[model samples]
Target chain A: MTAPDPRLSINQATIKYAPLAEALHLTAGAGITSIGLWRDSVEAASLPEAARLLAGSGLRFSSLCRGGFFTVPEGPARRVAMDDNRRAIEETAQLAAAGAPGSAAVLVMVAGGIPQGSRDLVGARSMVEDALAELAPEAQAAGVRLALEPLHPMYASDRAVISTLGQALDLAAPFAPAVVGVVVDTFHVWWDPELTKQIARAGQEDRIASYQVCDWQTPLPADVLLARHYPGDGVIDFAAITADVQEAGYRGDIEVEIFNQEIWDTPPGTAIARTIEGFGSAVSPHLLQAGARR
Target chain B: MTAPDPRLSINQATIKYAPLAEALHLTAGAGITSIGLWRDSVEAASLPEAARLLAGSGLRFSSLCRGGFFTVPEGPARRVAMDDNRRAIEETAQLAAAGAPGSAAVLVMVAGGIPQGSRDLVGARSMVEDALAELAPEAQAAGVRLALEPLHPMYASDRAVISTLGQALDLAAPFAPAVVGVVVDTFHVWWDPELTKQIARAGQEDRIASYQVCDWQTPLPADVLLARHYPGDGVIDFAAITADVQEAGYRGDIEVEIFNQEIWDTPPGTAIARTIEGFGSAVSPHLLQAGARR
Candidate 1:
């Protein structure tokens, strides 16, 4: 068998139960070279300390957990959200400055959910677009790329209304290269019939900022917000998708982000180790094989 | 508020734990004029006895609970599965014979899951098509319309690989009028971005056999075979979709098909009553308003 791809990264959320320092050490020890940091963990550790820990662990930063909750209509709530996103960009820049040269990670964006009592999905999407336009210039000046993460349609109501890669790309289409792009999480998008087509479009436009992997389980709860499976444990055809991503010319970090009660309950070290192994066995085979053929 | 639509029907699978006869009785008692039946329950009671019960109740049979599992590869397995489907079609004909004249309920078709250990979704879909070709002539002769139910992508592995109304319509595209059509279940298809387009297409082709609704819960499970919510209980934009369906000229029965464990554990009578109430309050308003404006 061919050697596994070395660019594989583990998102801190995959081992969310662990402390940042512990998660960093565990991820690096698992042979993963990069890590995506969540804001909550960074806030808890303080950005400087989190940066110091990463520096000590010799882990590359893939992308920051999130920056955009841009769907709060035009009001104090919207202004407050924009202000917070700016802080997020600043924090991301700080992390980048503290890290090695050329190791800057994108600031992942989760365009906010529908405003309370709002049923207009189209309106909510427009709000996200407006927010992106407002924030793009600042993000560009900070030397940080904004990676819009398209959540699953199940989340369109209460989470990010930008629920498809195509939709995200459409919003990002007119933006400058440094201003906006997209983050593809397997858990959020594996079921889409247009997945391959959209990913190719993202690549053609040079809009792929990140790629994530997870699984969709069978017997999902009627409330989909609570349901998510670990990579390789659910029904997603990850191999097929990774092949498509590569074919689309998206050479980026493959980050694992699973939201599971079982993984959360486990110790951080054990979870990270298991995630790495699952990634190697289930995900790497396809990428490695594809690379060999090429 | 306007009066509830008398044409709406409730599929007994919506309250899966309810006994078949009781679900029918409760639906009728709630002023619902129609009901959909599951074949397994009918088989348990035997078709003659089930027909007798329905005839006694004076309720319109909206559709039979499915006939196609045509994806098992050729062999005794394939032959046996097709024979079973043929029997289901005959059972549907038997029910139609016992019901009111010109009241032939459609026989719903759930294209089978992937054959054991197989990963080719395209191949499985083709199997469904081939099976439909073989079964259509017999079903047509028996005066039964096969309503192909496009299950969600979550079921693509072990259930119906036909995961979208568009895909189902595409499969049924070449067939003669009313020989093959689609069952539009909101629970299975609410997440589709192209749902509105496909619904209009189904109406254009005059191929909508049935319409069903349920909610999608958050935190979806690893197994989605069992995950579903009651109407108005989750985040799907039901009012928008119902209006679209109405605009498309689909004057079919709106069947509620919630597959929730909570509803199942409740008494059948209570579940059916609550479903009727929810449907009236949550779905009827937009539809009634649309009708008035038209």
Candidate 2:
């Protein structure tokens, strides 16, 4: 098979069961030069050790899996969520610092769902704005870009309330693009009618922190959270969306972030191998490659 | 229980097993004065007999369940869909003529998803636009309003490419509001950040052809199509959306079009009664009821 796309990053969730060490070794061994990590795995291996492993693997740290979930009403719970985000911000900074050259100090943010037992969707969304205003400075100080990821509308109620790239961009507007950016994930926003316009807007604003690739298919599995598929395996037009992101001027690592149970169950090496093949066939051609060239 | 909400319409899909005679009987028997119907049930009863039964029941026809599904690329298949929609338009005009005063000659349109095995979403969406342009004049000539219904984004790939009120309104813009309009269903659009703005826009354009209400709950069913619930059974803020629709000048029959399997299994009478209770408790208090008062 062709070598992994120079810009391809295997998001840790694609090999969910693989711990930090194995995930790192597998991604790097597969000749993938970059990886995005989940906080749990990093914390499992402990930040310093995870950083040591990442540095030794010679992989660029694309981003931390997540940091934002502070949709709670003002209370101790809210405080706890804020503290966790601060810790995540610190983790992202240290990890990015320890990675090979070309690493990005970015932390993906999934705005939390509506508060429990409450139908106050507007209130819940406002809470995300409040959290961003509170966390933006801290993230900036840590030299990290808080990447607001607008999840698919299917996950709006239970997972992430941010359901459109436009909404994410509006939230990120108050901060610098390098401080608060947006993630364009194919699986989440591929069906959007405003996708082309919004990708251009994100590019013009220079807030395209991460461009994730995956596919969406019908007969979504029992747990919709695991409904993601590798590039080219499902219906997402990666070429179209990648072209949009490329035109928008996002010259960054393109991460394959599938959450399918089948992919997670596959041997890590095999999973990474499939990712490489999928990316080479479905996504790499559309990329501008200036980032890789640099 | 308190009297059924005066403006509430029991959409026939809420009682899927009920035949036309039975559905009309259950709806009118429960003192529910209005209903929206599915073409399958209407066809099953035969149009003349169905009209006779509806006239005998002395109930108003809120709208027809659906008409549009012509997202297929230009072909014989697309021609069949357009012809079918024309028949649906004729049926809407006839049913409205047969119903009690205030019956609306509205045929709801669900723009079909991406054509089978075709990843051209934009092209598929254009098919919906083309279908509308072809049918709008015919519908107007028949005194029928084609209400473009934007299904939840989850169904964008396989059910309807029109997945937002804003997009539906955009598609409906080129036609006169009386000929082509939009359906504002709370379940499909409650998560949209621009819901209030779009509802106002639809109202201002005189294009609010139908106002449908249903709750959205998490842990969607195995068959996500049947994931709808009674208004009070989930996290949807009915008061908020109902008030928005009310303020937008949509003082028409509010339909509760549920698709839950358990609700479908319930006796039609019980289902109607439950819908009455749900609408009264969750939706009625917020409605201005000027239409009912008139």
Best by lDDT: 2
Best by DockQ: 2
Candidate 2 chain A: 10-residue stretch with minimal lDDT: A285-294
Segments in model 2 whose C-alpha atoms lie over 4 Å from true places: A291-294, B291-294
TM-score of 1: 0.88
DockQ values for all predictions? 0.27, 0.77
lDDT of 1 by residue, A60-176 (tens): 788898898788878898889999999899888877666544454589999877677665666777888788888889998898899999887657667788877888898898798
Which candidate has the highest TM-score of all? Answer: 2
Runs off by more than 4 Å, candidate 1: A1-4, A29-31, A101-104, A116-118, A217-231, A288-294, B1-4, B15-20, B101-104, B216-230, B288-294
Estimated TM-score for each candidate: 0.88, 0.98
- Itemize residue pairs with steric clashes in candidate 2: none
lDDT of 1 at A112: 78
